[model samples]
Target chain A: MELFAYPFMLRALAGALIIGLAAPALGIYLVQRRLSLIGDGIGHVALTGVGVGLLTNNSPVLTAVVVATIGAVGVELIRERGRTSGDLALALLFYGGIAGGVVLVGLSDDKGNSNLMQYLFGSLITTSPQDIVVIGGLAAAVLAAMLLLRPALFALCNDEEYARVSGLPVRTLNILLAVTTAVTVTIAMRTVGLLLVSALMVVPVAAAQQVTRGFRTTMAAAMLIGLASAGLGVVVSAEADTAPGATTVLMALVAFLGATIGGMIRRNLRRRHNRPPVTTEPPDVVLHG
Target chain B: MSMSVVEVRHLAAGYDGREILRDVSLSVSPGDVVAVLGANGSGKSTLIRTILGLVPLSRGEIELFGTPQPRFRQWARIGYVPQRLGAGSGVPATVGEVVASGRLARRGIFRLPGAADRTAVREALTDVGLLDRINDPVATLSGGQQQRTLIARALAGKPDLLVLDEPNAGVDAASQEAFAAALTRFAGNGGTIVLVLHELGPLRPLIGRTVVVHDGRIAHEGPPPEPAGHHAEPDHDHVHPHADEVKAGICEWAPTEGAKSY
Candidate 1:
């Protein structure tokens, strides 16, 4: 109860709750499309944006949103063109982004490496009022788009060619999804940190899928799982003196393990209960002349 | 005379820069079951893809329901069942959910699904004998069941022309029979169909016409070819000879200017 006593903890919890719900909501589509690592790629790109902001003495989150969005579009375009494999292109963008961040940050005279650490591993305690406001607005937009575009996005991710022949704007929607992913990455940076942000996007979905039979249920369960992992992880870390981002990700992994075991047990029980009556009989083979 | 349901003229299309199909022209009327037969890499899939606008034509035009492909916006009037399940194997989607997505074009993207959408989904599943497994994840279904789910997905749209790409490829005999039954019902309702098939199998009775693609050209178009006695085995691999090299040679004559002439 006293965990919410501190103003910074309260801010951290608020940011956590927003990202907890938004990341998995958008993440289910990425998981469906088999692009789970894309969030990590965008996260790497957001680091360069942070460096840009520090160098220009501007807000890092804003710059990160812009830079990461461009990176996301570039990656999506390359993947769409099919000239190169998706992972290969992401690797190129990933290395380029991190190296660019290091060079740009080294050139700046600000608080140097320590500031980047806050973005990389998350500094939930240092979340400013401005950070919360921006994160809230962007997260709300992401959630709204995910809800409004659920059918289209599901169809696109489910069967792109079918979606195309069905007269959906496949390319435009692809670009929009890429942009939405970019926004989600930047919005989650302060809460989960750039390095660990993708964990929130992916692990909960994996966990939820272990027990859920449908996409909608999986998405809903994933969000609830994500919310618990983030909110409770923050509280537990604050009490135990651990990193909130790492704690949150670890909690998600624990949930995934639990779900997997539970699912296995449930399947076993169902199989036993519904087992068909076996009939042992001699083979009646038909011989041809 | 009723307008042709589908009219493809001089369609030349391929992947990358290579021409896979050249001078492919076909027409289908309402209540017709046209089977497109060909060998692997013989451009049968490419032809279907070109008709669906999944592949860009190097030359020629495609008209669906009398409307040019670029201008044709009535997608709900045409249903499609791709060769394989398009959704990746990793994602979890119920049979009902995937079939429900087929109604998206009818309802538009912004609006939520109404009672009509739900009813269509249920009926489609029932048509495929998958109503019992509506809540089950598609991943749990066998290959045949998955293909049936795709058929149901297309049927839920209630299209006038159902286009299927190898609907029975790798499917079990029972699933094929189920698919044939569904197609028979669709045809009974006056639905037109254009399908790409490797082997006629149970569908031979339903195919009113056959168009054979050999080396990217329509080598034969008429009544279905009577498979020789040796090739009469069920599920036999069908391969037509490449003796049509002369025809292929003629098609390559103006390859350089193929796109410009369109």
Candidate 2:
């Protein structure tokens, strides 16, 4: 009750909830499209944005959104040029953004800034009401975008070539996905930090997919799992005196493992149940032999 | 006579810089069942791809249903079934979902599927004899079942012309026969068909006309002469003896001369 009374805790909880809802919703499409690593890449881009914002004395969240969005578009453009796969392009963008951030941080005059560690490992206790508002608005935007682009996303996931032939604007959808991914990564950065945000975005959705057969069901399951992990991580962090971001990511990973094991057990049970009945008749000719 | 449903004149097509089809000209009329026969690497797939506006036409023109191919907006009138339905095709869809995809071109973006679309999907599944397994995962189905599902997907749009690329590849004899029957029914209902086939042993009887492509050109364009009255339906179901062993038999019958018009 005391923890709930604190404004910081309230802000942290709200931010985590928004990220938990939006990241997995966007991640469902990424997982289906086989570009799950893009989440990680965008997270690094957000880190770069944070570094730039800190140096310029600007709003880190705003800078994170802008930088990550540009990074997303850049990755998409590279993929469109047929130079690299989405995963590979994301990898290049991710490492480049991280390296740039490192250089920018080194050049900064504020060498003993404690905020740097907060950006790296995440800090739930430091979230302000403004941060919560930004995360909430971003989450709403992401959810709206996903709802509007569901059909196009479905077509793209099934077959891009077929989608083109079917009169879909594949390039536009690609750009949209990239943009939404950027927004998701930026918002998610506050929960798991830049280093491990992708885990929150991808793992829960992946685990949900193992159990759900349909696209809508999978998305719903992923959101549920993400929310559960985020809430559990917050409580555990408060109780154990650990870092909230790392604890959230670790909790998500544990959920994924649990889901995977449960899926395997269910599959094994189904196989056993579906097995054909064994014959009871003995080989009569063996006695004569 | 009315304009041909599909017209390709002096069309040249290829992937990258390597040309596989050169100076290919052909016109397909409505209700025509044209079999494109060729040895491997003989540009059959390229021709189909070119017609579908997938492969870029380097030279010449293509017209569909009296209009220039570029202006052919009636995609709902055309259906296509690719060579193979691999599990990795990223379709990870149910039979019903796969069939529903056929109506995508008909239903523009942002419009949810209505009752008519659902009826068409169900009818298509029924046409392919897969209504019982409409909810089954496509990956769990056998090769024949998967092929049937693809056919159902193409049929769901109720297209006037269906282009099938190697529909019978790797299928069992019974399934091949069943597929042939389905194609015959489709053509009998006045739908045009252009098929690319490597083995013409079983399908030879059902095809109305044959065009052999070789070295980026039509080597022969005429009615097939061997197995007289080949289009007649067979009475016996003997499992198509020597079907697998007849690969050598087909290679021996390859055209020895350049293309000759019928």
Please give me the total number of clashing residue pairs in predicted model 1: 0
Candidate 2: where are CA atoms >4 Å away?
A83-91, A109-113, A274-289, B86-92, B228-262
**Candidate 1 local lDDT, residue A217:** 91
lDDT of 2 by residue, A1-289 (tens): 4686877887887788778877888887777776777788888888788778878888877888899999999988988766537656667788889888776765666544466777766777788888888889889999887866666677677666666656567788899899989888887777788777778878888778666655666777888888988888887887788888888878878887887788778767766797642212112122211
**Model 2 — interface RMS deviation?**
13.2
Give the alpha-carbon lDDT of every model.
0.86, 0.76
How well does chain A score by TM in each candidate?
0.93, 0.89
Model 1 CA deviation exceeding 4 Å by range: A83-86, A274-289, B226-262
Candidate 1, residue B235: how far the Cα is off, in Å? 22
Clashing residue pairs in candidate 1 (N, C-alpha, C atoms within 3 angstroms) = none
Look at candidate 2 and give me any clashing residue pairs.
B219-B259
Per-residue lDDT of A44 in model 1: 95
